[model samples]
Structures are given as C-alpha cells and as structure tokens.
Target: MNAQREKLRMMLTSAIFAAIIGILAQVTIPLPLVPITGQTLAVGLAATILGSKYGALSALLYMLLGAVGVPVFSGMSGGMGIIVGPTGGFIVSFIISAFVIGWYIEATKATVTHAFIANVIGMFINLFMGTAWLKVAASLSWPEAFAAGFLPFLIGGVIKALLSAWLGIEIRKRLASARLLPYSSSKRTA
Candidate 1:
C-alpha cells in the first residue's frame, strides 16, 4: 500500500512537472527560426529529477498536450501545425535530449560535473536538429540557418544548463541524504 501510494505520488509529481514545462514554453523571446524559451530548463530539470523513462515520458506528455491544441508551446502556439513548423526540430530534440541527459546522468551516478556535461551535449543535439530543420523549413542557407536558429540561443542555453545542473546536483544531494536515491540498487550497471 505504501509503495503504491509512493508510486502514485511520483507519477503525479512527474505530471505536474511536465505541465510546468508546457507552461514555461509560453514564456519566450521572439526570434527568427527558433525562439528562446524556458522549456529547455524544464527538460533538463525533468531529466535530472525523474530519471530516463519518466523524464522522457514528461517531455512526451508536454508534446502531446501541445499537439492537442493546448497552446502549450512557445509563443502560445499549439496543434499539429506547431509540430511541423520551422521550429519543430527543437521540439523533437527535447525528447532525445531528455532521454540522453537522463540516461547519462543515471549512468554516471548523477555527478554534478557529469550532469553539466550531459546537458551541454543535449543542448548541442538541440542546436543541430533545430538548425537543420530550420534550414529546410525556412529555405535558409547553412550560415543563415545557424545564425537565425543556433547563435541567438547559445547564451540562454548555457545559462539554463548551468542552472539545471546546479539545481539537479542539489536535489540529488538532498535525495541521497534522505535515502531516496538508493545508490546500490538504483545504480545503472552499463
């Protein structure tokens, strides 16, 4: 009964965070190609806190919410149109980023430096996919695509990554102290 309750609690918490990610997407800085948004911070936080499966699930939920016309995506956009828009690659990258970062953190035993590295790598993945998609969708040249899509968000991405890593490390430390993250059993042996 206790375990079931805990599981339920975790699920609820995950769902709330996923919704938070969606809400954060509404707060954005308008730009060409890809707009800067708080969604990446939420993605990093979710991956760090919820582990690979749950983190990915949370991102998936966020995407689903937006696809259903929830106005949960950046600039208050939603529906299938947003999913196939010029910035759609970034949305797709969110799923991959969450999975990779979460898995890397899990594999590295949640070290602070490792978490930071994971997020940095995830950001690059986002950049690559986003820029590539923007190029094709917007009929932009390589330099133009990179300038419009990748360059503008570099600093913001760094800030988000740093903040997420710091927060994630702190959370991990607290959870470890509380015996919530049981190292012996939870350790990924890969």
Candidate 2:
C-alpha cells in the first residue's frame, strides 16, 4: 500500500513539475538559434526538489507534451518540426540536464554547492548539444553554430545556474522542514 501511494505521489509530482516547465517555457526571448527561456531554472528546480528519477520523468513528460503538437516550447511552439529544427537539441537537452542535476544533488546530499555545480554541468551539456544540432540542422559551420547558439547564451546560462541553485536549495530546505520531501531517492543524511 505504501509503495503504491509513493508511486502515485511521484507521478503527480512529476506531472506538476512538467506543467511548470511548460509554463516557464512560454517566458522567452526569441534568439537566433536557441531562444532564452526560464526553462532551465524550472528544470533545475524540479530535479533538485524531486530527485533524479522523478525529475527526469518530469522532463520526459514535458518533451512528450511538446512532441504531440502542444505549444509547450519556447515562443509557444511545438510539434515534430520543432523537435527536428535547429533549436530542437536544446529542447532535448532539458531531460538530460534535469536528470544530471538531480543525480548530482542526490549524490552530494543535496548541498547548495553541488546543486550549483550540477546546474553548470547541465548548462554545458545544453550548449554542446544545442550547438551541434544547430550546426547540422542549419548547415552552419562550427564557429557559426557556437556564435549563434552557444556563445550568446553563456552569460545568461551562468545567471540561470546561480538562480536555479539558490532557488532549488531554498525550496529543498522548505520542503524538508515541512516534511514533504523524499518521496524520491533524496532521502539523504543531510
């Protein structure tokens, strides 16, 4: 009975986080290659709070929602065309980032510093994948891809990383205090 309850809780939590990701995705600044979005912060928050499995699950749900022609992506866009587009890689990277962030935080007992490090690592993954996808999908050279996709987002990525770190830590602490945490694997000795 307890196991079934936990599973249901995880499903509901992931679904809620996925919806948050979609809502935040709508907050964007349309750029040339990858548009700036509040998505990364939301992803980090989900991962940090939900732990790895549920966090990744949340991102997967968001991807599925976007793939099914829902406008849950940046600038209110979605569909198979968007997924295969130059910016699709960035969208795809969200799952990986959320998972990595949650895994790292869980491993580190969900420390603030670890959360920040995880966010940085996830940002780099996004940059690399998004840049590569932009290169191939848009037929741009490596330098052009970096210039249009990666470089422009570096500063903003750092800002988001910091913001995500702070927000995640605060939320985790609050949830911990409220005894609403660790229906995930984040039942740490911290």
Clashes of each: 0, 0
Per-candidate RMSD, Å: 2.9, 1.4
User: Candidate 2 — which residues are off by over 4 angstroms?
Assistant: none
**TM-score of predicted model 1?**
0.88
Writing each residue's lDDT as its tens digit, candidate 1 over 1-190 gives: 9677656656776787789898888888887557889999999988877777767778888888888898889988889888888888888888889888888888786766777888888888888998898888888999999999898989999889888878977775776567565453145421
lDDT value, candidate 1, whole model: 0.81
Whole-model lDDT per candidate = 0.81, 0.85
Top lDDT hit? 2
Candidate 2 structure quality by residue, lDDT tens digits, 30-112:
88667889888888888888887888899899999999999999888889898899988988888898888888888787777
Stretches off by above 4 angstroms in model 1 are: 1-7, 175-190
Q: What is the lDDT of residue 141 in candidate 2?
A: 92
